[model samples]
Target: MKDPANPTSRTPEDDRLRRRIGPTIRDVARMANVSIGTVSKALNNNGSLKAETRERVIAVANALGFRPNSLAQSLHRRHSFTVGLISNDSFGRFTMPIAEGLEACLADRQIAVFMCNATDDPERERQHVEQLLGKRVDGMVITARRADRRPGLDGALRGLPVIYVFSQSDDPEAVCLLPDDEGGARMAVEHLIGLGRQRIAHITGPERFEAVRLRRDGYRQALTAAGLAEGEGYYLSGDWSEKWGYDAAARLFAHGREPPDALFCGNDQIARGAADALRERGIAVPEDVAIVGFDNWNVMTEASRPPLTSVDLNLRALGREAGRRLIAMIDGTPMRGVSRLPCTLVIRESCGAKTDTLTGTEDYA
Candidate 1:
């Protein structure tokens, strides 16, 4: 029998069924002593309302276990509240961090992200874009493994907001977010210069890459700023690999010429390879020759003997900024031009500096 004072009380089975059904917006409106529209406004964070009233509605909703129907809310707002992320990073090295950062930024706003990998295939990318467009995603983010300029999407997005992360777009009006390769390289070299290393050599990837060219320019600029001559044989350009680094280091020490006091490698793998080659030659790191690398890749940096001081591109931060800018564009704000985010120097034992010291900051512009 039901208790007279508690008419809603029911058996355990009935309570279980009620729990399954859950509470609705109407329940929240009734419990909060407000109209259904007021509850909708509070829950959806739409329309101006008294702060006290909003708080009360929220509290009552929480107590009643009320959850709004996302489909209904989206229909009312005319926004899918979803974003599409497209990438060509098959290895997940760059895409993963960017996606994580993008998700972190969008989650707070109750927006969802759909990730699609193009794997260097243009047809596949077009298909993904079309599918996302069909789903009516609010915006899209395009990324790539390398920070190179890529062609714009093939489809007519009807003025849909699109952001390029870790990639550049040929369109002058397209928003592109990239790591400041030149600035980062300059910072790395400046750090080595501050250590009083007079003779510095650069070992890097092929000249075809924009990153390689920018980093090379930065290295040269830093050296020139210090009144140091960039020696004829100081720059070695090759494929980005440990083998190239090892061979390049050997060449630097070849021809009975004076060896450099420091080496700035384009990537951590190369730096590790150079360190190994130096080890075989009985040259002590920092004491004899210091080294710095880009990418700050943990697998190579942490594993290297004496570790490695490296430049971190801050990819995650770039992604977060990309998300913010995309949302702004979606909200009718215009964003254009290229924005270069700063890089950080993660100091370890390799450069003879105090271990685990982090430094460097550049404005996003």
Candidate 2:
């Protein structure tokens, strides 16, 4: 199934728009591998973090030129530079990074964020929107739980300068920012081909997800480009779970002759499952098979025995873009449609790479 999403341009202007003025707690939290609130508590000596963790966080904060006094304090301006953040995702894995990215961009300008979790509930969303508007927040950033337009969303958000993250509105004129899923998937599969792996196969998430279709297209395009599209069943669809990977990989090897030498997974979890299944069958990773995953999630990527090579949708950049776009709109700049950020391929051991090979992110410099 196709996703109800669109893409936007990540041109040089977008990059410059995300550049901000000063350092904030968000900066320190990122440098110290902690949360923004954690940084505050650590600096004030008010929390229960491990001694070493706190110290490390402090050192990192200092190194990054962070000041405790500046934490959550607005710039010396007359107005409170507050913005409302409405998101339907509570898991934080996706929403948190995006929020942090938006915070980073806003923090540069000394803007405070008031976050409201909609939890995919329309009533809650309306309530939060009404509350933010009542508080007279400068503007708002809204994101859907599944990155698709929801009912009453447009109506509830009617008079505010709004920017949509990872989702779009029914209005063709709305400003949205989404990750380039098609491009990211293409980058991953092409990297595998570049590594001299010909017998490549793909296993991805539910067919209902637009990500699944886009990544699959990327995989197929890469294969066809290399004149290797003749293979059958090299593409498979399954649920977005490690168990699906395990089952799918096991079924492929049931043939017991000439299995694929490289596997491209839709997400990190499936990659881990596929790896585990391969290992159980005495198949050596990167020796007999190479793997690449999407999402570039650190825990899953790093925890795998050889680590995983995956795609990073750069939620931080996405959020930063959303914030910048909203600020521009609030400042009387004309904005329309989706502004898409490119995805990056972060290389690790699972691909048998000698060095990190990032495709769509940036130069090594």
Question: Which structure among the candidates has the greatest TM-score?
Answer: 1
Please identify model 2 stretches exceeding 4 Å from their true place.
1-80, 361-365
Model 2: per-residue Cα lDDT over 1-365, one tens digit each: 22346345465655655454446678788777788878877886876888998898888877877664432333332234788988877877788888989999999877888999988787888899899877667788887555555443555666668888877777777777888777888888889899999999999988787778878888888888988763577788998889999888897777656689999999999999999999999999988999999998998999997899999988988888888877787778887776667888999999988748575753211
Task: Give lDDT for model 1.
Answer: 0.90
At residue 61, candidate 2 shows an lDDT of 75
Please give the TM-score that candidate 1 achieves against the real structure: 0.83
Model 1 ranges off by over 4 Å: 1-69, 356-361
With candidate 2 superimposed using the best TM-score fit, by how many Å does residue 216's alpha carbon deviate from the native?
1.1
lDDT of 2 at 44: 67
Highest lDDT: which candidate? Answer: 1
**Model 1, 1-365: lDDT tens per residue?**
56789988787887777689798788888888999999988887889899999999999998887888866666777798999999999999889889989999998888999999999998999889999998888999999999888887624576899999999888888899999999999999988999999899999999999999999999999998998988779999998999999999998877579999999999998999999899999989989999999998888998999889999988888888988998899899988889898888899888999966555566777
The true-versus-predicted C-alpha distance at residue 146 of model 2, in Å, is: 3.1
* Per-structure clash totals for the candidates: 0, 3
- The 0-to-1 C-alpha lDDT of every candidate, in the order given, reads 0.90, 0.81
